[model samples]
Target: MTDILVSEIMNRLNSLFPSVSSELNSINDYTFLIAVLLSAQTKDKRVNIVTKELFKVASTPVQMLELGLDKLKEYIKTIGLYNNKANNIINLSKILIEQYNAEVPLDRDQLELLPGIGRKSANVILNKICNAPYIAVDTHVARVSKRLEFTKNTKVNKIEEDLYKVIPSEYHTIASNLLVMHGRYTCTAKNPKCSKCILKDICNSRNKYF
Candidate 1:
């Protein structure tokens, strides 16, 4: 798509989702990081359901360590990959306390160094917390970007790179969340609600369901 079309898509997205943000429920920075980590391969609704109880008992790194590994697993067992997630959460919590004084790192490199925090997770943290211009390409973001012709790449990193090049910097921070919301609701993988979509007139996807 041309830059003008991309700009119009962004404008529509911003108008549709004026308050772009994650749906994961978190009380603080520590809980927010943990919520995002636990959200891997899991739905935000599921993550929120588990974290509601998990955070009550262990909202901080020190509290997480005190909660112990096995107990933490019990709380998040309903989530996929709970065993590995529990282990990473514990280990990352230790790193946070020992290295950063129990504070979530604002730097992308430092955040990525934490257990279970990949580029996508780090991008989310940096964008949401630090208000940085980083687009975290999740499944929804990737699908929407491809269908919109914002990118032809299948790899998330490449898609993110394409978005950075295509989307104006002013909308960079909100791009991921906006696209995520759009894909999750309007431009779904199965039978997308193209008729109700703001970009329906412009979108020429084969999957469109009018």
Candidate 2:
């Protein structure tokens, strides 16, 4: 996409969702990291619901370890992949306490080394917590990018790379959040509100309803 088109897209999305940010509730950085970890393949609203009780008992790495796997599972059982997620949470908390001085690492590589954190999760932590310039690609971001013709790539990593080439660095921090919010509420998987979209005129998707 051209710079002018990218700017117009960004401007419209920012206007539509001006205060777009992470919806996952957390008490602190540690809880935020844990919340993001649990959000894989699950909605942020669901993760927030689970974390409401979970964080009350265990908000830190040490406290999370004390919560133990069984109790942790009980707290997050409503979320998908709870069993594995519980295990990863407990294990990652242990690593944080032991290796990182009970702190979530700012480094993407170190964050990725954790049991549940992959590139996408690591990118989120880095961008939101550490103020690093990285576009964390989730299903929403990928869908919006393709629909906008920012990229034809299907793989998350390649799409991310393509987005970096098209979108300026100054907009990287809010890019994913804007796209995610748009895809979640407007350009949804089915029956997208094309008629109401500001970018409907520029949208290249063949599936535009209008």
Candidate 3:
């Protein structure tokens, strides 16, 4: 049953949105990591807005550290939790320079060691930058997974485990992007667009309050 459902979701998502990658506008690892950190509890569009100004001045760990927290905060103040985010970015930058030779660590464990970087953030970095098969369960992924009856578990970790088990190995990375886009545009939190959704027939949450 899980396999059948997974196949259906994969087929529909691929047909609807064929391309799936990080929508962040960044040219380097440092900027990418900063954008990911800023993305927590924030929208990608807003992250792009803040990162554009921040990256223009400081796109490297050394440059960021030299900018100092106060100035950094000033640049990213538009983002939610800007204070904490700025602190984390600064500290993470310092650690990067001291430990990874100013490179975003590819290893999940090493990446998680940095401030503000949790499992989801690490997974996104690995999947997007390293081309690894990791499904990062943000709010969208978790909500959509349960609504689709892909997992009974509400916990983020369990949802991730269920998805990994049900999703085909080839579609893991694409699945993350597809699910995220689906949640953002179709299976929305407030009012889902089920009428226009291609997966409405199979969607367990169709016609139900989102």
Compute each candidate's TM-score over C-alphas. Answer: 0.97, 0.97, 0.96
Rank candidates by lDDT, best first: 1, 2, 3
Clashes of 1: 0
Q: By the lDDT metric, which is better: model 1 or model 3? A: 1
Q: Identify the candidate with maximal lDDT.
A: 1
Off by over 4 Å in 3: none
Say what the RMSD of model 2 is: 1.0
- Please estimate how well model 2 matches the true structure, expressed as its whole-model Cα lDDT: 0.90
Screening candidate 2 with a backbone cut-off below 3 angstroms (N, C-alpha, C), the clashing residue pairs are: none
Q: What's model 3's TM-score?
A: 0.96
Error of 1 at 157 (Å): 1.2
Per-residue lDDT over 118-180 for candidate 2, one digit per residue giving the tens place of the 0 to 100 score? 999999888888677899999999998999989999999999999999997788989999999
lDDT of 3: 0.89
Which regions of candidate 1 are displaced past 4 Å? Answer: 206-210
Count of clashing residue pairs in every prediction? 0, 0, 0
lDDT of each: 0.93, 0.90, 0.89
Candidate achieving higher lDDT, 1 or 2 = 1
